[model samples]
Target: MPNLRDHATLHFIVLIWGFTAILGKLITIPAVELVFYRTLIAAILLGFVLVQRRQPFRLSTGAGLKMLGTGMLISAHWILFFASANVSTVSVCLAGMATATLWTSILDPLINWRRIAPFEVFIGLVIIVGLYVVFRFEFDHAVGLVLALVSAMLAALFTVINGRLIKKHNHTVITFYEMAGACLGCILFFPFYVRYFFPKRGLVLVPDAAIDWVYIGILAMVCTVYAYTVAVKLMTKFSPFAINLTVNLEPVYGILLAFLIFGDAEKMTTGFYIGTLIILLAVLAYPYLNKYFEDTKNAWKDRRAEKRAEKQALEKQNTTNQDPALETIKVNR
Candidate 1:
């Protein structure tokens, strides 16, 4: 079981992750360039930490390739995530990303080869309803919302993949390779990004302002390196469901922070808030509903077992009563 400290640590990690969007928006560079720098810096930092701790970075070729692919997914997730915020308000971006839990519920069963739980589907439907509400109110930001939703799906995918990888590798080692892979992935995409997306400005490899550098540094070091490393480590103690459930609170923290920092810019219509509340309620209520259903199932099983035992006892008693001669013979013997 996880201790209170473990839960607290996970929440702290989520808090850091929540700040990531604000940092992304603060930086002036395009989302792709920002991801490139973020990943490169994170890779360097994690590499230094590994060298200092004398941790080996060796892995099988197959695993290395897999990590690289996972890194590309992570890169896409970050690009879309930041792009959503750039195109729309932070609240809209976060509201769209908040659908991650629902995606996870759908994806986990398929990925793990488990039967889909009806209760999980019900919760997913509830979240969809909430998202619909947000969509209806914030129709102007539909494109950004769609991008963020896709980003959330990618986030859920990589998370499930990491759930498999962490069992066989150290969290730090995994992060080092993944970050390196993400950096390389970004580098490979640079040409296409420049050609198609920013043809007019060309490639933007550096931060435009000094404060942008500070924000990127915090994003790479504090958010990416520290928070991600700790989150991966905590996965050893916490189930993916529990971790993702807690992460549902990210939007709550982020939106509140955005409201405080960006003021009116982050505020949404009343319908958006209502929609967000519905989604949050479903996310928050999932664990309780799961536990209740599981407990009920277990209790029913226990009662059935007790009934079987009692029936067996009565049947034996009746058998003994019917066979008095045999019982008497045995007793005499």
Candidate 2:
């Protein structure tokens, strides 16, 4: 467990992450362009850090390519995330993003070729029910909600893949490459985006106001880079499970921050709140439930092993005594 200061630092990190959504909304640009700038800046900053540390930038061909590819998914997730806020209330967007836990629960099993625990399945269904309630009450924001949900799924996928990659590589190296890839993805996407989806003469590459630049810088440096660095450092003190459990508070922090920053624009209906509460409750409970089940499973395995050992020992003793008795009888005869 983390101490009080560690807990505070963890929550502060989460709060910074929550602010990213607010910054996205504050920036005046298309979601695609926003992602491009964010990725570019982050990649540049991370590269400088690596060079300063004298760390090698080179990686195996396959691993290098894999990290880069994962960047496109990251780009898509942020694009959808910002777009969600643009299309609807920040509260609604955060609510949709909250379902990321549900998506991860489902995706992790299939991706890792592991069985999905019964508890995970049950929690997923319950989350779906919460989503349905929100949908029924806030029908007007349906498209935004859908976009946010898809973004959550993408985020989950990226997380699962990144978990594997991190085991064999330095996180900053992987992230630097992924940031470059995200930038590349945006470059490739720009032509098609302006030609069809956005339907403009050219890309909206520049920020109109100075504050927009300020917001974008904070989004990249503070939220993306700083927060990640802190989390990695704290990993030595906190188990990954504990860290992730704390991370589940992201939506709660985001929603609160949205209300504070955006005021009336962020408020939603009573039903929406109820449904969101349900979803959050399930997400927050997941780590504890998973830990309990995992411990129970290990206990059962140990008990069975002990029983088998005792039975084998008893059988060997009975066999030894019977063999001596049979030998004595034969000798007497």
Candidate 3:
């Protein structure tokens, strides 16, 4: 069970994640510049914390490479996430990301070589239906919604990959590698982004106003570095499913924050709310359903093991009592 600190930290992480969208909206820089700066700051701040605490910064060369690769995916995820918010509303971007659990369900089997349970498929389908409802009627923001879904897919992939890396290394160490990778990815993409997306436009890298600095600080220091590390630590106590489900509430929190910050611009139609409720319902229900299925699977495995043990015991008794002639016949047979 989660303790008070666990609950408090989890909620705080969700709140920080919620503010991510708001910060993205408020920053004056473009998505590329914003993500580039965010990762750069987060990497530096987190590196300082790790060094101050005297944590190990070592990983195997192969593991370090994998972390860097995952970090690149994380960079892509954030870029898409912020771009979604820029083109559409925070609500749409967050709502689409809420489907990450569904994506994980589908991807886990392929990555881990496990049978994909029917229950997981069923739950995933239900979430898909909710997303369909949201996008069908709210088609004005379909492109942004799609981009957010792509972001969610990338998020799920790297998140699962990180779970493996965490078993062998500290989260801070892994995070440092990933942060470096993200910075490199943004640097590599900037030239292409400028050529294609902002052709003929002069470089606009720095924040224009002091207010932009505030948003950037919140995004980098609070949301990215601090919140991410805290959540990584909490995974020792809470299940990933539980953590992720709570993360779904970030959309709810973000939408509310959007309303408070942007007021009329954040308001939506009745259909949007209905779709949002359906998505939230699916997000909340998934953890319970997953736990139940896991329990059932373990129970069945225990029963099978018990039956096998009993059979082995009976066979041993029969063998010990065997007559010489019968033993010889059995051997010949």
Which candidate achieves the best TM-score against the true structure? 2
lDDT of 3 by residue, 1-333 (tens): 789988988988998899898889888788878888888998899899999999989878898899889989999999999999999998888888888888888888888888988878887877878887888778999998999999999999997898788788888888888998998899999888888888897457877888898888888999988888788779879987888678878888988899899998878777777887887887788888888889998999999999999999999988888777797999999
Query: What C-alpha lDDT, on a 0 to 100 scale, does residue 323 get in candidate 2?
Result: 100
RMSD to true structure for each model, in Å:
3.7, 1.8, 3.2
Predicted structure with the largest lDDT when compared to the true one: 2
RMSD of 3: 3.2
Model 3 misses residue 299 by how many Å? 0.2
Clashing pairs in 2: none
List candidate 3 stretches off by more than 4 Å: 318-333
Question: Candidate 3's error at 48, in angstroms?
Answer: 1.2
- Give the alpha-carbon lDDT of every model: 0.90, 0.92, 0.87
* Candidate 3 Cα deviation (angstroms), residue 18: 1.3
TM-score of each: 0.86, 0.95, 0.91
Go through the candidates in order and give the clash count of each: 0, 0, 0
Against the correct fold, how does model 1 do in TM-score?
A: 0.86
